[model samples]
Target: MAPSSPHRGVQHTLSSRGLAKLALRFFSSLRPTDCPLNCLGKARLDFNLLPLEGELHCLELFQWSLLYQGSKLVATQQSSQTGLQFLHCVMELQKKGIKFINREVESFKNIHLKDGTLEIPRLVILDTAMSLFLNLGAFEQCHFNCGNDTTTYLFFMDDLIDYAEQMRHLHNCGIMRHGLESDAEVADFFNQICKEMVLVSSRSYLSYLSKDVNTYFGNKWNGWIAILELKYFSNPWSIISLIAAFILHLLTLIQTLYGVFGYYRPSS
Candidate 1:
């Protein structure tokens, strides 16, 4: 009889060996920004799961976009009172009745719309973690509204767009290579992410992306905000200064740990 087939876990483990090497060798190299996308609008996004102090871990969103004709990094509207909002143009299309489409999305249409009459469907954005993975598979970039007030964002579109340009340049250079050392690095760094998903039953890895993206942005932003808020604190300068100093040191430590130390954020 032929050799027994590799168990799903074994296949995952084997596939993961390459990723593990990637992790040991280059995992921490993942940019603080977002994952890169390909010329075909294929990209992987991550939204780390951020748990709320209260109870529910709400799904957070990020954005994916493409650079049109020239090498342009598109900009979106921002507001301090609200938060980071992405895909305004696409969101507008919802008003015109365009529907977002994807598999594994619940009864709701894939596009962010409430009423699905389709004539520019109103943006019925669900706070679903699954959207991130699905969106990455579907679109080049996603639009995100992040930060407390929500104006802050983690835009993956530009990263992928930039990668696309680099790929084109490589293609022309006679040094064009099919596999990217960088993406391999990213995929490796994000191996834990993929591993976590494989452990689950969800065939669609998009939701995990949302979950990862959410956690990453939420924690980083909150940390920054706390740091910023402490800067102006003046009730008892000494006490505030002490606390602020600790926070500042922690921030730098985390950055350095992930940056210099590689592959570990030290689990804040």
Candidate 2:
């Protein structure tokens, strides 16, 4: 049997040649890093350097898409065997108030050399505040196309835990139920790609959320109930009226006592 890709941790054990192959596969599945909302390459690369989950993986030469210096990818959460639901899910994601892209990736056509040989992609070691980055290797002669073709060149070979672009796409789809040091660091950066849901909007989905999440929602049910119950009646006049009623009762009590005894009058 062949070794399989570990799906839950960072595997930095690939040989130089293996690493090169992994890099090619990573970029092959991507659009471009320069698009308005491509992956948070810097942070995701940091996280991928930490850990990931994949049962198996294999590298194929660029076969689809226009891989350029400026393009964005659709979220892969919807890229099941069914097809590219990125467009269908995009609006749904937005309806949930997330800030991520709300469109489906039609296709990604990879342009290979006429001789069918992929170039050795460029790899560089770069750094940011407290993290390191494995920059995207360039493909001077390579091209990619992202239209509506729903065929991902990913087949199970050895599961590489740190498949950069794939990991980034998963994160965008809110699949990172967990992460690691470098991955955690790019959290804010990752979150920025998509808008978070409004508190209420997110709550709306809590019904279908995991059991643990639903439990938390149940615990905080009082907060939402309060909002729904009093949201309409919350006004200045209501508050003022309540205060006035209390004062009136106190004044009435004082008058009743004074009239009952007329005060201990001295000779006036």
Candidate 3:
């Protein structure tokens, strides 16, 4: 994000990258080139004319920009029915008397617009894991809210998700949009991000949500019923197979009783 603000002894640390000297020279060059009086106002400096070394510094800045940007939205793997499926699920939930509620927290970065909707000023970009973590760490230090509501969301995701199967479960339930190459990648992303984050306290907004979710599954009957439905009758073919099995069992029981009572023997 702003190159970590040129920390004390950073020159020594950045020496390996060979950008230390070039960065200072680039800044020094900016004064003579970037700030200039033109016909209307100060002329926009042409970055193309800079030396190769200066260009490298600019490249580094660009990398920082991506890392400092907003959280990378995980794109849905199936793009075609994304919107339709999301709407269908919402309507189904609504019919079941499920309601969506938003809790209004005192947010430092959330902007209240004229429409009465909260919006966060964010820039989304893709970058390496190391770069993303470093910039996020820097952003946490600078902002009291620690990147606004995103911090809370990330913390929640970290606690709820731990493995590839867990990520897939959320995706199947339409709760998560999996954009990575694999479910493992999504799991790795959260696992790594949690390690990098500086959590303010142990308690978070999603603490109740996590507890409720766990409690729901903790009920023996609830978990068993869910397992049974998903395991035996999740699809049309599975339901058909279950029905066929029930019918076959009934017929076999009738035949066994007929033979035991001699009903099928000698026309009895």
Candidate 4:
């Protein structure tokens, strides 16, 4: 009853006022101006959620948030065929006991397979998307392989995740990790990333992976069987249903044969 906590009331009021002023100032600075990146002529800057900062752009903030939150930008739903294919190829490579080494040394040798093991240098994807891209460009300059594996993977992922729906598709299939708050964030990450990634169309580690995937899909029978396997084994219920169907079919065939033989029994 000592002045009824006046200090606490004052502190709360000050905090609220400060936050309101910050929000107002932050929102007021955003302009819907065209991008300075000449290549993207019609694209406009939309600062709906984030505030404008010098050299600290939206993509940087988004990526920082993603890493800070220890979140993986995953697909909330199934991804497109291209996305699935790309992810599948990576998984296949991983399954093949491939080793990715993140070395400080600059080596041009991109993809090498020896003794049923594949090795490729790793690239770091950090909070700074632009910086990460610039570093990759530098890598292309120094490394003999060019920005083959890292850049190609970036473009491949960028192509796969054009929207939230496709991101969800990959997530649903366990191919993507969910880290961002929403699918839109995941899509936006790639959209902005692709815009920054200038390197495209070159040999990389993924080239062989891409070829293998295309070849696998090119075979109609193999593709069909893979689809069937995915369809039947993707979920336990489907697997149960498939097994039940097979059992029922077998039983029906056996009963039909028995009846036919019994009906044609020789009179003894």
Candidate 5:
């Protein structure tokens, strides 16, 4: 007789494994009532009774699992004002001395603010991103249990990008990349995606982040520092000119003070 093929042996092993798994599932489904202990006599108990204690324990476990999962999705606290209103465009934030940094993570949920830098996960926009986001937004809206995470992200992005210049700033900062023809298209994509959609910023994951950004932007000192950095510290020549001007003013003040003192005391 010809030797059995190795292929047949492999198929037989897989088939046996499949049968074993099926038998395990089937046996696992049987309750203690369905397959009673052999020691317990039939007259001693009713097989029709449900296992109330085991069922209650299982239900409690399921509820706890859900609560644990929901807690993981929660971020910082809600803002007093609407979070969206506090979010300035990218250019505005840049002008206020807030730096934009690209986070290497793939998840949009990873956006955060630290110090004065806003770190956002890189978003790669393809031709299909619009449809994908729309479907995800629609699904989140229709399903009550599914949180509005995608909707919140879209709205947050929309608030950050009011025009092509803002989108270009985000791109220059490495926070966003797109295959769209122009920056204007990317700007329009975000602007249009969240149109007519109602989002409660207090419930958003980005609420606290937006509030922090606004606080930083509102500080007058940061604006002054930004202006100084832009006007004088941007290049070596500007910095030299500013230093020279400061030295000149200091020398003139010292000369005036020395002359007044010498005249008053008539020099010892």
Candidate 6:
């Protein structure tokens, strides 16, 4: 007869029910002040544990973990606004002199816009990303008190990426990296995940960021500057040609003025 398997005994000892009971007991032992959020908040307030500049604090780390766990902290405010519908695509924003900057962070909350520059954390998309986001979105929809942060993020990305070109722009800017076959696939992934999802703009953390971006995009001066840069200063050759033309025009104007002065008041 074959020897009894030790692995089988270990598996039997760690049954699903036993694990569930252990988790329940662990949670039950925690006091009201020991909740995850409360603990993180307390840690954040501790001066000794403060992180240096360019480092993430305790609460941010906790929020990042929650992001990967398919949940998020609840928003304190709620408004009747349906969702963010005024966001422009990547190319359009670029044409409006709105620059995209990669924050090089892993947290979803690391997105913000300041001084016409919109900073976003880098997003890595692998083969499993689709399933992961879909499952997270489903959980948010089904679980009570689970905010739709992930869904809102997906919607925001979908709005930014309208086609393959936009996806390529994001990849080139280091704001997104993907192992997909083509840029079109990445764009399609965001579009597909955001389909049929309801978004409350006021509840989304990116609402203010979006407003700031839109305000920058709406500025006529920015648009004019973008057009000038794209048309006349796009390359070294173009810039040199513009300078030469301006000099020629100035010389011609000066010559014409000198001749007019000579004609009006004859120089003896």
- Identify the leading candidate in terms of lDDT: 6
Per-residue lDDT for 64-90 in model 1, tens only? 221111111112221122232323222
**C-alpha lDDT values of all predictions:** 0.30, 0.30, 0.41, 0.45, 0.66, 0.67
Please rank every candidate by TM-score, starting with the best. Answer: 6, 5, 4, 3, 2, 1
**Colliding pairs, model 3:** none
> How do the residues 94-143 of candidate 5 rate in per-residue lDDT, one tens digit apiece?
88889988876423566778888999877777787787667667766765
Across residues 1-268, which tens digit of lDDT does each residue of candidate 6 receive?
Answer: 9997999765654453354334434433221111233344333323222123333332233223434322233432342243455599999999999888787543465578877788877777878777666766776676534566777778889989989999998888888888789999999988887885666665676676677788888899999999999999999999999999999999999999999999999978
Cα-based lDDT at residue 42, candidate 1: 23
Best by TM-score: 6
Report how far residue 121 has shifted in candidate 1, in Å: 34
Candidate 2 global CA lDDT score? 0.30
| Model 5, position 148: C-alpha lDDT score | 60
lDDT per residue (tens digit) for residues 123-162 in model 3: 1122343364455455554555322234444555565467
- lDDT measured at residue 44 in model 3 versus the true structure, 0 to 100: 15
Show where candidate 1 strays beyond 4 Å. Answer: 1-4, 7-12, 15-18, 21-24, 33-152, 155-268
lDDT of 3: 0.41
Off-target runs (Cα >4 Å) in candidate 2 are: 1-45, 49-233, 260-268
List the candidate 5 regions with Cα displacement exceeding 4 Å.
Answer: 1-71, 74-85
Query: What's the TM-score of each model vs. the native?
Result: 0.17, 0.22, 0.40, 0.44, 0.70, 0.71
